[model samples]
Target: MENDGSAIALEAHELTKIYRMGAVEVHALRGVDVEFSEGELIVLLGPSGSGKSTLLNILGGLDTPTGGTVTFRGQLLRMDSERALNLYRRDHVGFVFQFYNLIPSLTARENVSLVTEIARNPMSPDEALSIVGLGDRIDHFPAQLSGGEQQRVAIARAIAKRPDLLLCDEPTGALDSKTGVLVLEAILKINRELGTTTALITHNAVIAEIANRVLYFADGRIVETRQNAVQRAPGELAW
Candidate 1:
């Protein structure tokens, strides 16, 4: 699908997710509505259980919502089947999470190559690693790399497919402040340089300063949305 000049990358309307446990139904998302523009970086901030991760998963096609709709480039998401969702995810989305999820036995280059091999059109493993500042360590195994480096490799593996959207869920949750900053910097760089529509879930409010837009979630809803007049670089953020 061709995006119009205004270029809305993704849209979600009245999104709701519920989990059933015996007789209890727990609401994870309740009537959430949001939009992500092309090349824009968004930060989702909220306390635990506020639905930030739930929204991200829905947007990434990893989870189906109980109600409402989601669209990408004006195409309605086929959430009715896992096969369709998996195809959508493979074609359009990349994901990063708190855990690196790297294969311990594979070299960093090999790890990234795994995704590129299946992608319709993908960059070389070295090229993807280079974007995240791991050009020199592409051959290093995950076991030999630091936590920060492993995370960067994960980022590289995600983006190597040249996905249109990148969804990150607490990607820096496992790192120290200094190392977290590096990971954030890599994400910022990817969004800016690759023109990837990026949405990141972070508990650190300070990290919101690095985004084009900030969304605050509470009680399974987006309580507030703010446009950052002046976006800060990842290095400029206090945490």
Candidate 2:
């Protein structure tokens, strides 16, 4: 459903996640409320164990909240049904994790093709690669490419399905500063060109400058929220 103030692509209300380890309980999230506006790029920033990843997982349907509701396009997420959640994730969400999970034996094109084959409405593998600036490297195997190039291939695979939401958890975490910036550029390019609602989780605060809004997480809660007057290009960031 749309937010009163803006178009809400997705949102979580009164979210909480608690893990039980015998008698001890750990709260990964605590009564959080957040919304992702359509076509906006929002970043979550916090130290380790601050629940940024937890929140991302919940939003992406990889994990369920202990007490809360996640909604997409005004429909409530079915946390109780694995089948529904799987379909939702398969059809609507694109995820890029810190590591490039490309199959070592597959060329970039083939790697991306795996997703397109299953997607109901997918772009060509080559087209996805082109969007990430990897058009020329489509036939290269992961080992034949640099780390940054491989990461871009991973990103291309994620976007090939033409998902409405792109949830990235440290898409640049394994790269050096220059390479990380390249990955960020690819992500921003998708958001700008395709109008994907994107959310990124990063430990580096400099990355926040590239987002329309930033959520500062601490101890299982969003402690501060900042909205940028102007989004800086990823190439302009250094960390």
Candidate with maximal TM-score: 2
The sequence of per-residue lDDT tens digits that candidate 2 reaches over residues 1-239 is 22337688998999999999999999999999999999999999999999999999999999999999999999999999999899999999999999999999999999999999999999999999999999999999999999999999999999999999999999999999999999999999999999999999999999999999999999999999988989999888888
Candidates in order, TM-scores: namely 0.97, 0.97
Separately for all candidates shown, the number of backbone clashes (residues 3 or more apart, or on different chains) is 0, 1
lDDT scores of the candidates, listed in order: 0.93, 0.94
lDDT of 2: 0.94
For residues 36-112, what per-residue lDDT tens digits would candidate 1 score against the true structure? 89998999999999999999999999999999999999999989989989988998899999999999999999999
Q: Considering summed lDDT, which 10 consecutive residues are worst modelled in model 2?
A: 1-10
Off by over 4 Å in 1: 1-5
Segments of candidate 2 deviating more than 4 angstroms: 1-4
Error of 1 at 20 (Å): 0.7
